[model samples]
Target chain A: MAENILTPEEIIKRGELVFKKTKLMTDNELSYCPGCGHGVAHRITMEVIEELGLEEKTIGVAPVGCSVLAYEFMNVDMQEAAHGRAPAVATGIKRVYPDKTVFTYQGDGDLAAIGTAETLHACNRGENITIIFINNGIYGMTGGQMAPTTLPGMKSSTSPYGRDINMMGHPLKITELIAMLPGTVYVTRQAVHKPGLVRKAKKAIKKAFELQQENKGTTFVEIVSNCNSGWKMTPVDANNWLDKHMLDYYPLGDLKG
Target chain B: MEDVKLMKGNEAVAEAAIRAGVDAYFGYPITPQSEVIEYLMAEEPHKRTGMVVLQAESELAAINMVYGAAACGKKVMTSSSSPGISLKQEGISYIAGSELPCLIVDVVRGGPGLGTIQPSQADYFQMVKGGGHGDYRLIVLAPSTVQEMADFVELGFELAFKYRNPALILSDGVIGQMMEKVVLPPQKERLGDEEIDKRYGSWATTGKKNGRERNIITSLELKPERQEAHNLHLQAKYKEISEKEVRLEKINCENPDYLFVAYGSSARICQKAIQLAEEKGIKAGLLRPITLWPFPSKEINKLAEQVKGILVVEMSAGQMVEDVKLAVNGKVKVEHFGRFGGMVHSPDEVLEALETKIIGG
Candidate 1:
C-alpha cells in the first residue's frame, strides 16, 4: 500500500479533533411536539451558540411553557425563570457578566400577558439583553388556551365559542409596541414556517446577537411560530395556517431596523 | 481626592449611578425624581459612559427590569416617586426573595393617590418596615443633601452587593429638586473577575459550563425544614447587617439636658429647632440617621445616660418613635413629635414640640 498518501485528510482529521475539544450539546432526548416550531427554534439557537463559539460565555434564560427543556437541550449555562420573568433573569446575568451574552427564549402568552411588565421594561430600558419571543397565538403547554396575541375571533378553551374582542379586548401587537420605544435598537418580526423566511429569520436572530456584541441596546425578534398540538392542526396545516393568519397580524421583516 | 460638582440631588443621583459603573438604568418619569431620568435620557448616558438607561412604560416594568438586571450580577438601579414606588412593591418583593442586589431611589412626593408633587418623608415607615411582601428587609439609606444623594449611590451599591441584598436611597422632593454643591468621589472600575467569582460566582446562576452543578438562585422551599432553614439563614444575614450597618449622628451631648433626633427633611427642620433652642441656651442637639432601618440604637443608648430625655420628630404620625423608645431602654424618657397626611412638620412645630417635651420641664 502507498502508506495512505493524504495530506488533506490529516487537516480533516485535525479539524475533527478540534471539534472533539469543543464543548457541544451532547446526546439527550428532546421532548418536542412532533413538527413543532419550538424544535426549529431550539436547533437554530443551538446552532447560533455553536457558531458564535459562545458555549461557555453565553447564558440562556428560559421561561415556562414549551422551552422549559431548554436547559436539557442547550449545551450552555442555563437557568429556568418564573413565568414572564426570563427578561429580568437575563438582565441580571448580563449585568453581572458584561462580557457574556445573555438571552431569553419566551412564549407569547408568557411574554405578552404574564411577563408583559418585564418584557416591555427590559426592551424600553435597553437592558442590553436579547429576547426571542415565540408568538403562536395560543398557549401550547397548557393544552391550548387563548393567549394575549390570539386573534380576535379565534376560539380556544378560554373562549369556548370565540374570542369576542368587545369583551376580551383586541389582540395585542407587541412588536409595534416595543418598536415604538426609543431604547430599542433592533426589533424584527419573522416566521419559521417557510424555508426562505426561516433563512431570513435565522439571519435576523444572528444579527440580534451581533447587536448585543456591539453593546447596542435591547434586541427583540418576534418569531411567529406554530403550536400544532394546541392549534389542533397537523404540521402542514399549521404551517399553512401561520402563513395565512400570523403573517398578516405579525407582518414579517424588520419593524425597526 | 474627592471631585466636587454643583448639581441638584436627583441629577447627582443620575450622574453617580453612571459613576458607580452601573450596567443598566430602568425608570419611569415621576415628579421630584423625573429630572433624574430626564438627565439620563437627554444626556444619553446610555451611550456616553457605556451605561444602559431606559425610560420604561410604567413603574411596574421599570422595577422588574431592575429585578432582571440584578439577577445577572449587574449593577442596576431605578428611580421613581411615591406612588410609583408603591406600584413597584411586587417586583421589589421578588428581588428581595431572590436576594439579588440592586439600588432603588425614591424621591418621594405627597400621596395617598395622585397627591401633590411637593416634598414629604411619609414613606419612613414603608421603607423601614418591609414595604413589600415576604419576610425580607431592604437596606434603606436616607440622604439629607445633594452631596449625600450622590454619595449614597456608591454606598448603596457597595451595601447591595456586599450583602447580596437590595439598597434603596430614600429622598424627598426638596432634596431631589433643589440644587447644591457636592464633592463626588472619583469613579472606580467595577469589580474584577477574581473578586466577583470569589465572592458571588458560587451562588450566582451564570451558565452551567463551569463543570460544576447547575446553579439555581431561588427562594422557594416547599418543605417545612428547608423553608425554616432558609428563613433562619436570612435572619442571620439580617442580624449581621444590622450589627454592622447602623449609622447616626449626635450634636453637643456633653452634659446635655435634652437630645433631639430626626432624619431626612424633618431632620433639617430640627437643625433650626436646635439652633433656636441654643440661642436661649437649651444645649439642644440633632441626631440624624443616615441609615434608618438599623435605627442607630447604640448611639441613642449612649446619649440616654447623660441627657434627661430624647425627642424623636418625624413627618409620619410618630412611627419611628417606637424604634426610639426601644433604643432608649427607659434610661431617659422618649418623646415623639410628628405631622401626618401630606403635612411636613415645620421647624416651628418641632420647636414647639421640643419646648413642651423637653425644655418645659
Candidate 2:
C-alpha cells in the first residue's frame, strides 16, 4: 500500500497536480475568520487577475470592512478607501489610468448600507471598473451586526430577537438594483461555498474582468457568501445554512450580463 | 507679450488647471464655483490635453475621487463652495493622512449653514485650522484676484507635490465670480507614466512594476505606536512648511501709524482704505497674507513693532483676527472689523473702523 501511493515528487513529475495557488496572492496569511467566504472570494479574484496577465496593470480599491485588509493579500497596487467609498475611488483611478484595469472589493455593509450612494452613482455614471461585492448578510468585521442584506427573521447582534421587516425594512436586493442601472453592462449574483459553485463564481469573476477591457460600463459581480463566526455556527454548518436559506432569497445567476 | 484673457476667477482656475497639465478634475456643481467645472466641461480638457473631467455625484465623491487619482501619482483637483467643502473634509483628511498630492479650490460662500452665495471669508478658520479630523494640515493659498486664481493653480500643485500634501486655493465668491485680466500660462503636457514613475516611484501606487513591493495607499495604522509616529511625521512636515512657505504682501509698511491685515477680496478693500487713510493725513499700511495656513505670523509679529495699532478686516465676523492677535501677543492693539453674512465692507467703512477702532482707540 505504501509503494502504491505516489510520492509528492512523483506526482509533480507525472504532472498530476491540477491546481496551485496563484502568484497574484501574497504569502501573507489571511486575517479573515475561519469558514468566512471572504478568503475564497479574495483568492478567486487574484486568480482571475493572474490568469488574465493583469497583475502589472491592475489597481484594486479595498473597502472598509473585513475585506479592508485585502490590499495586504491581493498582490497588486491597492488603495484602501473609507467605508463605502471604494466605487468612487475606483472611478477616480480608472478615469486617470484609463488603460489600467481597476476594480473594487466591497462588502454588503459597505456596498449596500454606508456606500449605497457611491455604489449607485458610480454605476450610474458608467465607470469602466469592476466591483466585487460580497454579500454575507451580516457585518462580519463589526462582530455580526445587522446588515442591509441580513435576511428577515435573521438574528444578529443588533437584532437579537430577529430582523423586523416592519421596523428595519426589507433586505435590499442591491444586485437587482444595480442591474437596472443603464450604466451597468453586466451584473451577476454568484456563490462559492461548494466546488461546483466556486467554479461558477470564478467564471463570473473572469467575465466581469474581461468585460472591463471592453470599456462597456460598470460590471458588478456579487458573491453571496457566508460568515460562520458572525452567525455563531461551525464552518460546515454555516455553509449548510447558507445553502438552505440564503439561496431562497438570493438566487444565484446572471442578472444582466 | 503674453496672451491675456478677461475671464471670471472660476474660469481662470479651470483654464489654468488645464494648462498646468492636470490629469483629472472631479467636482460637483456648487454655488460661486460651478463655473470651475462648467468651463472645464465646455472647454473639453480631454479633447485638448487628454485630461479627465468628471462631475461627481457630490462633494464627498469628488474629494474621494481626488484621493484615488492622487494616490496613483496623478495630478488631480476638485472645486466646491463652503457647504460642499465641509462635505469634502473627511476625504481631504484622508488624503492628508495618506500624504497624497492634490489640489482643492474652496470658492467660499457665506455660511454657518446654507448662508449665502455671496463672497465671505468665514472659512478662513476652517481652512487654516485643519477643517477635517485628525492631525494634518492643508497648504492653504488665498488667491486675491482672478490673476492669482490662475497663478495659484500652478503654484498650489507645485507645493502640493513637493511636500506630498494637499494644497487648497481659498477663494471667496468675489474672486471666484469676478472678471479680470489674466495672463494665462502656456499649456504644459500631462506627465506620462514614465515621468510619473521617475518622480513618484518611491511611493505612488502606479502599479507594482520593476520588481518593487506593491504600493498601498492608506491612512489606516492599527498599531498605536505606528499611528503616533505617523502623526509626528505629519507635524514635522507642517512645521517645515511654516518655516519656508509663509507668503504675504506688505504695502507702505516702510512707515505707518496703523496697519490693516486682510486677504483675498478684503485685501483689495484694505488697499483702498489705506489710500483713504493717507488722504485723511493718517499713515496706514496693508499686510495681505497670500498663504493663509503658514499665516505669516513672524511678519505680523515684526509689523506689530512699527505700527501703533492693527485692524484685521474680513468678510466674515473676524476669524483671521485671532491669528493676528496670537502673533501680535498684545505688543500693539489688535482689533477685528467685518461685515458678516455675505456683506462686503466698503473702503469708507473699513477706513472709519481703522481710524476709530485702531487709531483713535
Models 1 onward score TM values of: 0.76, 0.97
DockQ of all models, two decimals each: 0.27, 0.80
**DockQ of candidate 1 against the true complex:** 0.27
Pairs of residues clashing in candidate 2? none
Model 2 lDDT, full chain set: 0.94
Best by TM-score: 2
Against the true structure, candidate 1 has what lDDT? 0.80
**For each predicted model, how many residue pairs clash, with residues at least 3 apart or on different chains?**
13, 0
Q: Model 2 over residues B1-361: C-alpha lDDT tens digits? A: 7989999999999999999999999999989899999999999989999999999988889999999999999999999999999999999999999999999999989989999998899998788899889878999999889999999999999999999999999999999999999999999999999999999988888888878888999999889999999999999999999999989999989988898999999999999988888888999998999999988999999999998999999999889999999999999999999997998999999999987897777
| Candidate achieving the largest DockQ | 2
Candidate 1: tens digits of C-alpha lDDT, residues A55-156: 667777887878766777766666666678788667656655678888899999889999888888778768788899999999887889999999878878
Error of 2 at B302 (Å): 0.8
Identify the leading candidate in terms of lDDT.
2
lDDT over C-alpha atoms for residue B216 of model 2: 94
